[model samples]
Target: MLIGCSPSYDTSQAQQVEASNKQTLAQAESSLPHKAVVYQVFTRLYGNTNTTNKPWGTIDENGVGKFSDFTDIALKDIKSLGVTHVWYTGVPHHAVINDYTQIGISNDDPDVVKGRAGSPYAVKDYYNVNPDLADNPANRLAEFESLIARTHQNGMKVLIDIVPNHVARNYQSLSAPEGVEDFGFSDDNTVEYAKNNDFYYVIGQDFSVPDAINGYQALGGEAHPLSDGQFKESPAKWTGNGSRLAKPDANDWYETVKINYGVKPDGSYDFPRLPAGFEHKSAAEHYQFWQQQDAKDIPNSWRKFEHIAQYWLAKGVDGFRYDMAEMVPVEFWSYLNSHIKHAKTDAFLLAEVYNPNLYRAYIQQGKMDYLYDKVDLYDTLKAIIHDKKSTAQIAVDQAKVADIEAHMLHFLENHDEQRINSPDFAGTPEAALPAMVVSTLISRSPTLVYFGQDVGEPARENGGFGQATRTSIFDYVGVPAHQRWMNNGKFDGGQSTEQEKALRDYYQRLLNLSHSAPALKGEYQELDTYQRKQNVVGYDNKVFAFSRFSEQQKMLVISNFDQHNGKQFSLTLPQSLLKAWQFNHTETQYMHDVLSQIQVVYPIETQADGTAKLEITLAPLQSMVMVL
Candidate 1:
């Protein structure tokens, strides 16, 4: 399971492997309950209304959002959407403009930052809250603490970003706790590699800023006191994107420096790999394993991050969404995540891991609570939405990950992805209905909804990034659709149009239903074959059907990806599911379409052998979650 050596397998082979993996997972019993619906809100942009939207606008021109913006009403509204957790992206102190040097904060060189507002992944201080998020700059941490308290009071837990892969090019932690040392403060700057050093420095090379003739510049060519295109690292450290060059290309993540987690330039691990088959152990067990047996020596970088995690956990933070977690060693994750679970057993540890081969290792050995299901289900669903792929492919994607399905965090959009309604994506917001349904209902996995995606925020703002298809994570700008829903900080949809309101209503209804039903728990049966049976008509590949059931409750989900036309189809329940569910077939059971609030008193038709066949019709771009 090396990086580029992923093994190739046919469908039958994959299924066989999956069946064995399922046995392994069933033995481990690693599946957590379906209880988390995460709402990912960009901490910097959620409440900003200044729509000047100038590319790389100054903080004053394009006003920054404060922690105060997530008022009780806003948190309650989000909770009402059935969100159990709010992932506040960029809550940590990251590199940015807007001088705080007067308050002993170092002035960030604009030439090295991504925009007037820097990338959230470019963490500057591990122990502090971002000053830009504070109404009164000095009380940033207190404001963030207040936001966390308010969020919990509204019955929602808090999730903040923990960027383990890298830090800003100029890494300094001014507000770090007393007796805490800065990241590179104690590093042997002249060494090419050191097990205890936090960052890897080139032996004799001087840091030189990349030439800006690539049409990228700080402030979009506007001037700042620190926009001199000069940073002072005598022996340049490795760039965050893993560029070892002294002068990293402009296309690379040159604004940040990569963290050295006991890894070497030769691609050799400096830490010990978990003994064979450690995949089935729980975080608590892993913690005990480390405590009982010091199998491998620990690194200082590991100790620093553990302290950082403990610091936030002490401050009432419930979970963390690790940035580019796969980039860091899964061994380090085992150490850090075990420590976290050792402290707070239920603390959620989410990671961004895309390699299919690495999923099991990260989940079992690393003990992560969740991993982004981007490369598998999300990609397939997006392709199906755009008519670039078939619905049949979804079954393959799902089957491939059947073992660890519950740990996969499902989402249609997030900060790094293209917006649903963007031209580069599906041009219609309505297309999201079926995608969201399939993503949320397909498994017992956690569901995530980006803040403005509920109202179809096509991120078309040109904020000096490569492409504007994604909301500008780099610059200072207001999200137009989100602002209308914000209603000038009213946290109400007062200015939203009829279409926007209806779209939002659909989200509110569907997301709330995600938790209200018992269908999300134990067993699931796909109904694709039933819908397209031998004698059925009016159903095409444009439609998908599935069922979710527990002993107490059952749900049959039907979604229409055919956005332009209605569909009339017949459903034929499989004898296998019928036996598995042990449905009471002694009488004709009336099925209630909970989504539409419609009921079929006597099923569409009942066959001689006690099997049920129901003929149903769906509106264009509609999804039905029916209870039987």
Candidate 2:
């Protein structure tokens, strides 16, 4: 059983103080049981055959596209990056309506129908694969299966994106039972029946007319009459700006209908309701009906997801990348996990929950295995790389990172968010190296790699919203490029731009060291630095040195976090341990002697210890961990 701490403690602290008070804390109290790396893929832009043989392809407005030449080969390359899981963007069917013939994209412009497939988030159908991507069913499945098999063969797992929050506008019309008037209506009655009375539309009577600033619009108007069984006036409106009657509602997902969480007929607490449209029935009757529906439909959905997972798992899938998992409810995950655990208990489930505080609520529910710890990672990276904070501050950030790792996923970028390679983050390939290094170093959960991040794939043409962002990466298809280049290197092809290589090597070294050292693995203990002002950090168990210390194999790790090229400092060993010991740089494994008096060099020397008489400098943003 995976043990866990009380999900209530605050993790934002300067450092881990009161060590004696925390020693009795169990490893389960430190973090959750998941620790696997995840890689995110934007399937559309991952590869294209026609352009540079890169794994990305372009898409037009009407949703027509060619097979990305890079899918199969790119999958092979992604597996070699030492990641355990691969998260593909939504594979569900989607469609885009174009008002004109012109094709281009503009920032913050919603009406312009640039020739691009609308975002996959605007899901068209849940049951069918995107036609463009399903060119050769057998081949695609085989390729996907091969990917999964390879991942699992390498001891990994897989997860497919499932959009349960809302269905595509065409979905209800396409899949709803015949004569279902409840398909597209916005009224108190329909809303009550559809969402089980858990939610209410904010109307003019209850509140002032909502403005367009937040994308609010009136539903029933002179041009558009209210559908039957719906209120004549509603807050929902079609934001798509087309004659299509079934577009998602602007206020509450115009294309997708909100699900009703069954509430008491007396308008009290909420509960689950029947899936199929059934109203005017007693709560007991409704409960029984929903139970029957769940017994049949949920099993099928579960089997479908499981089969999708198996397809990749059979291909050697490393782990899972879950999307909008919080929307699915705990019951569904509990059922899915029971079976998935049988297949691979070690399989990582990296969920996407943007808010760190909300993550705690989910962890307490035990509904998920892990959540993306982006907030902490973001704070740490920004402070160190952007704000240029001190090592002590960075150490403080690392503690929070450790706390989040106890129960969430961590990464620099993923499919749902903008690419780190975007213009916002120094648009050049040079940005990737430091980004990768910082991401890999402080990642508490399994690290996540957005697709094409390794190869320096450019940001999607249009903020990654519609077709512009869905380009394919099949351009690099059938090419014999160095896999290392894909894993680590700048697009410029220069030796000075080898941040990827260094970071890649660093990751491998760290991961390998973690595998070999118990202290580095399993659970982490927040160490203490006697001099916070000096920006020096130390951990208990004499594990602070740059070497691994197994009873039979003692090692120490130390670092000079200064920002300059070559500076030196001295470290005092804890009085409890012997002074005469051998030390090795964690990355280089070079042996060095450490006497009672030790001197170390750093590139940027921001930390100075007046009491211990120690001063060290490190290259700008440079950090090192030594082993003794």
Candidate 3:
């Protein structure tokens, strides 16, 4: 309708326009799922109200203990923390000898060896529930059902552990039939015993048989000696010029064998060759037979473990915490997710992918609903407390919070890492409050709290596994009186130091706030930091001073990252948009005009340049939030 005119822009203006567009797109992509919380549990050490001296049952090297002795008072206590999901660690059957008992492992010493129970990663059997975990192995379904039901009733979900990588050493699956000589296929004309060609990825340089004439030295008969493959200076050498033998892709790994991915000549992988006693058959027939009977395919291998997962879901479990998820094929996880969702629409899937690269792949595939975002948590915590970074840097770091919230599983500590209260940070009790606050409040995804974290427990060396950081809280051999040191603050002269009390109270308040405030509940936006001081960091948005805001609830959150005394600074508050607001401090109601200017004071240092600096504070770091 108007006169035909060609619109044109200056070169600089066009470039600026394009840059703005790209920034907007990037921001949109980063701001995804806004709310979630995760809680971590060491199932073995959590509690065992029913069992005695066997909290983890056979898995406990020091014998079993009562679940009631756990540091957590009750499931209700966990619920009070406002976590959305709970991840249990190591819930699989493992090898008794290889994983739990070995040289330097003593049966009498609790610190060195408690019993022959094994690490859950050993994975003795996938289909059967560990008998030690339940009084009646056949009734495992009932026990698991009750646990899931209780967890849901407490307003939370449960996720068990799963390992799908390598199987246990000395597993029964690889054993040859009784009295059968030359059981596998023969190759290279070396057929005195079973042919090695039938073994998956087994080659001349991969393994070595025991030379009976050489005192079985090549066979590793001493139980602790190096394997024959390890002694070879060629392809199997573990170090020196032949260090390539230790490569993860190597065809052999101790007794744990590798699987062949390439198709066999007969277009099958199950049956590569028939035994000397069996009649020769077509490759297809061998494949069919192996598929039906091979241990790697008998519903327990990495490819077939989904059936066991289905069984657990039917038993009322809601989800799983996949162990060593990085080692398994992504295709398997995709398959598992499809099957699990079909069975339970609300099923949760949390993968223990510690690496950022692997986690990104899983997130892109959507195979995992959540993953442990350790790197982000670690970096953010350091930036906030340790580094005392500038407000602008914190703002940049906080910008990633939205991305983390979308797919990350936040946690303060887990069994795999050192305890948060360890001396590495601040051994004093004061450190607990600040750690808990950051873990629970600042995170975008679900937050996890390890067992024994509520009450301080020192990390100790694992008995059989050398230098393990995690330790059990339940002391069986000693009387409750002797263990009084662990539970000091419960009564008088207990271990609940003043710092511990402050931390607990602080945690309780923060959790209550998270539950009560919609602004703090979900979705965080990184606002511009106007004052980029060393100690004081400030951010504001239209509705809130910080990036955290809730439009529907009409709430805004402003946090002070200053470590020391009060700081005087100015912020360009969006007055036109924030009309008639109330400041959230001590739950008080104040007119917006009455609090246009405010000052925050902490027990840290301050510079005249309006920068906030924190003091050499102990544990329970200081932080404050203002809500409008």
Candidate 4:
């Protein structure tokens, strides 16, 4: 889940639009493809070929990628990797290092900005795409729409960031459509919270710069009109990272100011409350709930976001990845998402909500399609890869969230996480093979893979505010490995090493398998439980096993997490479990490996007590899927 640290979840395959105007969730999903593979790439860094990674480099020192970089060939290459959707991060017109004054955009005060290319979450405008990404700044919105059209032509959907919890400290909407009002444009700013106001302010306090610039300077100490150590906010609002200080702590989300969603300083709701059974209500009912209310009664902030979402939908955006979703009130989500679906049914709504206690409310009432399974699955998998967790515990963890598994999007790497080959992480890309296997095939949920993850980008550069473990989301930095695959804009791996090629090939095979395989569609049983019941000796903590079956296909997956190579073991499947699938020594069957294409005949040795023990062998940190 997108913590206040870094947040997001991802998408589903773009489905055919329903013929009928009104449809159920079941109907919308049925027409859509079965599984989703989300490819999340930071838009500004995706095509940058620069290798000069200075610590606090300006845009010139380290080049930035443009919207035009996603050529038809580049997108086709991405689609060929079995991706269903492309999440283009940092697309919105956020605070950045630029002068758009002639185009009606104002300069952002650098004292509050995080990096030269500022945080994407600190959005500066609601109705525009980033001018930094356009070849022609005046036509940026058209360029973005063209990118969306190109993505659709290549059969993939688009998802962009929508930070509802906050906006840039310098919030000014230069291009809002006619009749749309800017946030705080009509506010009664005297009080901390008003039903109609968009921001919560600390009256009588002029905003002061945080004490710790930490020797950091805007534009690397180059002077500019607005880059001086001063900003113009009187009666300061709460900082985006939840700091209430007039001069927020340097560590706070200092670049942005928090939006008020009708919640008072004393933690009381100022907006209309949902009824006790509202979460159980359908979207139509939720929409009708708003329809019944007077326009004046609906909170302005709620309506403002509704207008923002509808504007993007009109521009052909499929859905939004809401940042820091849990920070906003759940009722507002109920309000905002209901209106979003009303505009475009099957709009993919993914949120970064960390509280498991709030999961059901967020999903049921907020009408969210997916949330990040970070705190549970991703964290556990990371621990297992680092030898901090036992593979034996994988089955227990899966069983705990069996009911909500489909709604939890699975991933090992995203913007917030450490790269697999980074020194702080596992320090090797191959170490994630077993973990990736389980993450992609754990359930019927969507799976997300960060760009360059397959080829092992170590992200070793010191990119400004964030650390090296994560590819810096805050700086203008080039990813070393991905740039090799980019191969001077050919969108080919012509310059990649043999190991990098092998890793990408593995990912392609795995992702394509996840999208097509039949056994994965339904009926899961952990073989680890069977091993425990049999008191199996060779099946140790470093090894894990499971089965996925439907009427036609039955598949078994096993992984060995040991450090040393070639650890052979016997994984005993109880006679009862085998009989359930109609397997016997009487019929000799070959078990086919899905990824390797190597086949092995079943060594189904029948026990005197009427059970069968299957012989299985695996390499260190390797995973295999054998078809029955």
Candidate 5:
């Protein structure tokens, strides 16, 4: 269904739709478990205490954080904010500038690496951890396992990245299990497309690194033995971003090579297709279906990744965050993820998928637990906060994905997004408070927060690959705002400023609520539409409201996005909510704002028509969660 083309339903029509929805939602909640809160931390940057943030700096100049830095106190402090899973990004062994030749690790070609510390997505070895993150390079895998054990001991699950769609340009795995060969170990180099080939090839052409263009060169024009403007692939493979050129543009994902999952050059799938009506089937059924199929019919790359996931699961890793999931075939996910579920039924699988059209296919058919809701909810909230869109548009966006709401994960900031406090974005963390509240409590889906997001990290440093608003994932750099909270490895807020401390306190309260609130795991009903129809004097499109309720708890969440004006209005609740909560139509009800430390109560006055209204006054950019 087209999102914007759908007509807005009237109150009676909405009531009928929501009544059915509430029932379906309640049943869904009964079967599913509690909500989750994910804390995403860049492994190399989280514990780095170095103050130096020189552009394109080396590991020595800009020291890297080690696996040992996540001490018990640090894990406990992270758990204090109610995080259920910690995503240690860039944990896998990837291409980098450092030479570990003596330790049996070959030097990576600089022409194919993004920075001194390389792109984590360009994974080199799936069986090992990054050498840069370990105190003893030889003991990196053991150290990472210790970190995993530490995370699990703290009552949190461990999540690591799995870049399934691609690998480093010079992919090599030295730590594969006995008799398990590396990717592309025995492929026919002459053919462009083969059923078992691991990578797509440009036959007869040699791989050439794009020359320096627009004043940009490998390693920022620095000299290195591997930066000789050439790479050694005789039969060039396709670039990670699907660029077919032997010498892809510098702006393309030139550092990585695309993995083939039986997708031919003609865009036809070489593997078996999902039978009709399989999207409605459960993961276990999918697993059973695949188990019945001939093992030789499945693609070789799919089986390789399935073994890789099982290998990590055997080592106690809890879940995976799939990068660029849409680039690969959904059929492969159905095959591999079904195998993962067969091994660990409750394994957490999150995918980075942006296309709205493919949301349901990836979730239901691909067996993904969650997908990033970036194009719809996150974009709408950002526009509303910036005063370029109306809060009412949120209702339209939500309606588009109503059936799959619980599977659409919500987040305000991640490594790919600009910081909330960055000048290019909201310019102040406080300005985004309203949006953050709505993103977290608006659905039953999981909520993710970046490591430095709680303390208002602006990401203002111009480290390496051109000065952009986002934190540099490609370079070795210190995150100053996050370092302040690190307090030189103390894991205490000893050096945080007043504003930063207050912001983190608010995050702690909000995230803890998200983790513990039963109503958040229950059904949702929009209060924005009913309130808009009432046309209260001070209420405008800038203020949005919603209600979430279960048998145990009920809450009304409201937020004011207007940055220049305070709002005074009579917020209304429709009869649907009244029936859901079984509230008396003639008597008044009281609710206290549970979001703030200071106590404040509001009275909901019920009328003869079973509708209720509450007089509320909110400061600019303020939000509230009132509980009954």
Candidate 6:
């Protein structure tokens, strides 16, 4: 007589076991903190409610978002979306077209500024906040300090940008502390290179602005006293991108000047080298190691940035987002970040290092808390979303950085990247559902969400100096969709469309669940290979599957990237996973998707050789986290 096998465990006792395990897992996760979620908002763009998106518009024509715009209501709304940190980009004083001459700030020559709003990376001053961002120009510092206190009161940390590799072409700090001098102030300008000199000079050539190109002229060819193609510099310094020309090409970083960090023209270091084996040590240890070295060994530029970071920290700013971090020497980061850690042990230090090869070096030796996971994970996911590649590559990319996954930060949208809903990208926000799920849940890395990403901002406005498909960081423009969520300063979704509201709700649910889930902090294993080996019908490159589990919880996450079709298949669990979970092939499991709250029951059938199989179904652009 033939007999069917029952489940190894009884369903009646499942709830008790799950409850006990979850308690244990929660306790463990408490010791190993959950991954952070960072919300990066361009300080100038986030609160701009003006709908008049005039091209190359002056600040009067197109309004600017002020520090007062981020009211308590706005901050609390942001905190409710499961954000732990708010990176206020463009806070530092940069060159601008507006006449701040009355406030002791000189008007930037229109020839040198990128747009009427100017580029935030070309910081004009380090000791002051952007005048454009304040409600009152003379009281700008107090206004910024109040904003900092408000952010802390709302229970989220604040982050500002620090561009150490370059400064505005006319960098002048008006509010420096007593006895402190501006960059290039104490340098001997006649030399090409020196250890203590702040800049590299060309000795005899005067600075020249680039000729107009692509039917574009400075300030739209409008006449201004300073726009006569003349800027006063006795000897030219190297351009921010290392162009030695007196007149840099329009494509070069022409608006800013490079800072010298003890590297000579021959590409040799004048600063002391970090010893081998230092990359694996803690930041405190790195600080101690540097403390024993002679202060004279450090470069002058490094000390200047150190003072700047300390100044911001003293104002209650929690951390920094280092711009073009790779452009500066890695050793400088080791020195700067270690010293910052010495002052505040829990300070968050994130960098934009694009080279995957240098990821480990920057994180370990440079003492950075996180580096952008762009070239590998983000690019692969993008290709898969457009069907240019397969889902299989995600596993390979994950394996490549398995050891340093925690130090890698993941995001689908940021200021520098095209919006997911833009015509040049996915063309529809719905198409990014699967990619967003994987980017937020597949690893222990922190997650980043740009301000307007959740509301499906297409970046359709052709703001001058920055084209369509990406929000303009260089011009005065309004973010239409984000303003809908702002609801005319109410900071509610009052004016948002139903579709936009639904998308934001999805983001809120996913982010909050990710923030609280203990199993996400545990081990991960890829399940696509096991399913493919069985040759299951409808199992294709458009679908991805993975599992995360701990002593208290286990979850199987699957996503379908195909926007036009659904997927149904028999998913097989490999022997390795069965061994890890200590579940026999005949176990009958009951689970539900924590995201959508859809309950499911699956009886895992055993093949003759003890392989387990469970059926799964996913709609177009749908992702599910089946938790047990």
Off by over 4 Å in 3: 1-36, 48-61, 65-73, 97-117, 135-142, 170-200, 204-303, 355-360, 383-394, 398-404, 460-469, 472-498, 533-545, 554-620
Candidate 3 Cα deviation (angstroms), residue 303: 5.0
- If ranked by lDDT, best first, what sequence of candidates would result? 5, 6, 1, 4, 3, 2
lDDT (C-alpha) at residue 464 in model 2? 25
Instruction: Please identify which of the two predictions, 2 or 4, would achieve the higher TM-score against the true structure.
Output: 4
Q: Give the TM-score of candidate 3.
A: 0.61
Q: Give the per-residue lDDT digits (tens) of candidate 6, residues 231-288.
A: 8776898999899898888888889999999989888888877775555456878898
Candidate 4 vs candidate 5: the lDDT winner is 5
User: Candidate 4, TM-score vs. the true structure?
Assistant: 0.92
Each prediction's RMSD to truth: 3.7, 11.3, 13.2, 5.8, 4.3, 9.2
Across 7-114, the per-residue lDDT of candidate 3 in tens digits comes to 254668656755664465346434533344556765544443222333323334344322233223355666665666676555554444322233221122111111
* Best of the two (1, 5) by lDDT: 5
Q: Count the backbone clashes (under 3 Å) in each candidate.
A: 0, 114, 32, 1, 0, 0
Tens-digit lDDT string for candidate 4 (303-403): 89988999999999999899989999888888899999888887888899888877777877788888998887888888887778888678877886675
Scored by TM-score, the top model is 5
TM-score of each: 0.94, 0.59, 0.61, 0.92, 0.95, 0.94
Tens-digit lDDT string for candidate 1 (166-270): 999878887778988888788998798888888988878988889876677777778777778888888999999899999988888889999899898898877
Candidate 1's displacement at residue 489, Å, is: 2.8
Error of 5 at 415 (Å): 0.6
Candidate 5 stretches greater than 4 Å from native? 1-28, 31-33
Q: Candidate 2's residue-wise lDDT over 437-505, tens digit each?
A: 444433334566665555444444432222233222211121112223432222222322366555444
Model 5 agreement with the true structure over 1-628: per-residue lDDT tens digits = 3211233556686567556655754575567656889999999999999889898899999889999999988899899888999999999999999999988998998888988899999999999999999999999999999999999999999999999999998788988899887888888889987989998899989888976677877788898987888889879999999998888988889899888999889898887777755665678888988888888889889999999999999999999999999998888889889999999988999999999998878886798989999999999999987889999998888889988898999999999999999887899999999999999999999999999999999998877873667888888889888899989888678889889999999999999998898888877899888777877788798999999998889899999998889999888788889899888665667998889856777889987777888888899988889988
